[model samples]
Target: MKRILTAIVLIAIVVSLVLLGKLWMITLLAGAIAVLAALEYRTISAAMKSPVPMWWTIGAIALFFLAVFLRPQDTITAVVFSTLVLFAWNALATGVDRVLGETASGVLLLVYIAYPLTLLPQIWSLENGTALLLFLFLCVWCGDIAALYVGKNFGKRKLAPTLSPNKTWEGAIASVVAAVGFGMALIALGNWLSTNGSGYTRLHTSAPWWEYVLLAILLNIAAQFGDLLESALKRGAGVKDSGTLLPGHGGVLDRIDALLLAAPVLWFVWVVKEYFSLGSF
Candidate 1:
């Protein structure tokens, strides 16, 4: 219990620094995080006895970070094509060693680890993007806290016993409740900060309240899926935790799993909304 509390406080401090710090700092931190997560994922895949080529695994990590720093304006299609081609080549290079199902596993790793982590920094690159990024983190953090607290005490029925044995239906419901409540609070806060003004405020003066709500809800759903997806991955891998880097939280991958998934979805929504001049509400 003490370990959990200490972990929470440390995480809160780190998150506060990241969200409030300069963009470069955030990008650097996120990049480092991406590398660590990629390593953790590679460990899991190796443990699963995946036939992914060593060179391709290394290349995928490189390409992922390249995409992050370059923030390529028109290279998404190129990246996808390149990744697919490399995947095929890697499979072919393995010759008879590559099993029929191993190719799909390689593709899944790229999609799971590479694609999602690439979006973390992209969130900061959009207009009014800081708010969206912060909101994404908040939704995931709130949902995770809610699930933990609710499950530890009030949990009854299992949510997915095969995947996450600790997860419960009560916890899942609590997570949604916490997400919605956090979203509403953030919306209210954003509105208040925009209107009446406040100390240390970075919000745009003309930003609408509805944008906060919409972004929050979208992030919440994505975050939930992210957690569940990670759970499923761990189950498939026949592991308890992604790694033991963190004392109580498992690994960087375990801690940031939801953020990994949510970041990309949030980034896409922001990009589409900005390009189309569509209101977030």
Candidate 2:
């Protein structure tokens, strides 16, 4: 019940934000989420006994996200520069015994959490972006639902016994199937919106159906990998949950783990499609 309620509230918040259809709103939302997730990550790091420099890590996260909106070129620079700073700080502060793990954890948080979140606003900046972002959410949502349903019912072969015992091969396949099905549903909705929505652009279907199927598989798998990755992080840190930020959801990191891996791929697909002038993503 708590999980269901949390899902509903989360969907409401996300849909409301997306309906606002403003890049700033998305950026702000993503920034807020990034900060919270970073703090949770800090908690996890501390649990592992490798604390990231709080101010430096948080400041770098904010800066990289800002680059997501202000200057695309600066985004890469921000990450590279932040990484160097983190490494140097670790070397100076923690000394040799803990420097390697500390530096690696700090840098990984930048790439793993901050970087992918930057894509949320980037996706919003593209043509038919609102729809694409919604579709991305839908894909992840449906994939998760399907994984849960199928895994609970038929999951026998352990996908990763140590990291996430609940996950299974059946769940993974179901996630892909569910994402593809959601893609087809999006195609239907796009056709409807194209006919009825004046000035409201929907994601175009210029590519063949197979292309979309492939994209769905990629996204679903990426999201699954993200879930597994987070599980690994928690397990490695010897913690069951990242934080209690969200009810029934372990933490902000737990909730957005799928997006961490999924967003970069989604952004990349949008970029490639735009670069080729291939219709709306």
Candidate 3:
């Protein structure tokens, strides 16, 4: 428990510093994290006897880089084509490797790790990008913290006993509560800043409180799914904690599992709202 708390504090400090320092720093850090996560995914797939080709992994990483640095308008098409080609190539290589499940595994890896992560750069480049990113981080982090605390204290019904026995309905309730609190706090803070003429406000005044609430709820749900998704992967791979990449915390993948799922969902919602002129309500 002490170790977990200490790790959380250290992570918070590091994240705060990075967020305050430079935008490029955040991008670089996210890119490096994505690479590490991709490697972890590859390792898990290989261990599960899911044969992902070396060439496919390389190509996926290349696509990741292209998605991150290049603001190409055709990025979505490029990503789809790249993923398809990688899967097709893996299918072709099945004869050499004699693996039955390589195609499915390769496809999973590309979509789960690469495609969702591509949204990070897009979120960073939005008009209110920084606030949106911060909101994402908060939603995921708060959800996780709430789940942990509530699960420890009041967890009676297991949410998914097979994949993750530790998760519980009580934890899920706590997660939603925490998400709501965090969202409302952000709204209040934004309102305060806007009224005071402070520069820290990033959310638009036109954006409604209900939007934050909806976003928070969606983010919480996504975070839960993300954690479960990883749990399912780990169970299938017959391993624990992705890797021992972090001290006290399981691994980078474990720590950022919620963020991995929530980030893209948030970005997608924001994009859809913007495109359709939803008026932030």
Candidate 4:
């Protein structure tokens, strides 16, 4: 019941913000999520004996979002160079033993968390951006739901017993199937809305059916790997769950772990499609 309620509230918040269709609002949502997830990540890092300074980490991430909002073309280069300089400077004030781990972990936080999230607003700027973003949310959410229920009931062959004992190959396949099925559902919903002359734009995507299916498969695969990646991190850190911020959902990081990678994959696909002038997504 707690999980269901959280999912409801979360979906409401996301739908509200995405429907507002403002770049700043989307950026604001992404920024807030990034900060919360970063804090949780700091906890995990500390447990692993590589603490990232909270204020410094947050400051860097703030700059990242700012660059993404203002000079998106330059955000990648800026993020890379700024992280290097920032961490290198920090090393000067720390002992060699702790400096390496701290610096490495700090860099990982930016790449793994901050950078990918910045793509949310950029995605919102794309053609049929609202639909695209919601499609992403739907696929990921459904995939997660399918994986949990299916894995719980029928999961037997271990996917990665060493990293995440609960995960199984059966659940992983179910996640992909669920994501693809939901992707088609959203596409059908969009078509129905269009045919009825409804004002709803959140479910529509101009991409062909085949393209969307291929894209859904890719996104689901990325999400699954993302789940594994976070699991590996937690396993290495000798902890379970990133934090207790969300009841029945662990922490912000745990919830957005799939988004961390899925967002980037979606964005990359958009970029490639646009660059090739294949079709408007």
Each model's C-alpha lDDT?
A: 0.70, 0.84, 0.75, 0.87
Q: What lDDT tens digits, residue by residue, belong to model 2 across residues 1-281? A: 99999999999999888867578888888888998999999989989988888898779988897887888777889888888888888778777889888888888888898888888887766766766777788778899999999999999999999999999999989998999999778866775677785644545445566777777888888999999999999999898988998888779998889989988998888778779987665
Minimal lDDT window, size 10, model 4: 81-90
Tens digits of lDDT, candidate 1, 144-164: 899889998999999878777
- Which stretches of model 4 miss by more than 4 angstroms? none
- On a 0 to 100 scale, what is the lDDT of residue 245 in model 4? 87
Which scores greater on lDDT, model 1 or model 3?
3
Per-residue error (Å), model 4, residue 226:
0.4
Q: Estimate candidate 3's alpha-carbon lDDT, on a 0 to 1 scale.
A: 0.75
RMSD of 3: 2.9
Highest TM-score: give the candidate number: 4
Show pairs that collide, candidate 2: none
> For every model shown, what is its TM-score relative to the native structure?
0.82, 0.91, 0.86, 0.95
lDDT of 3 by residue, 1-281 (tens): 85588677866864574357465666666666777777777778878887566666766666665756665676666667766776666667556464347767776766787666667766766766656666777788888889999999989999999999999999998998898898678667767876786766555445777878888999989999999999999898887888777777776788778877898788788879879988542
Model 3 earns a TM-score of 0.86
**How many residue pairs clash in model 4?**
0
List of clashing residue pairs for candidate 4: none
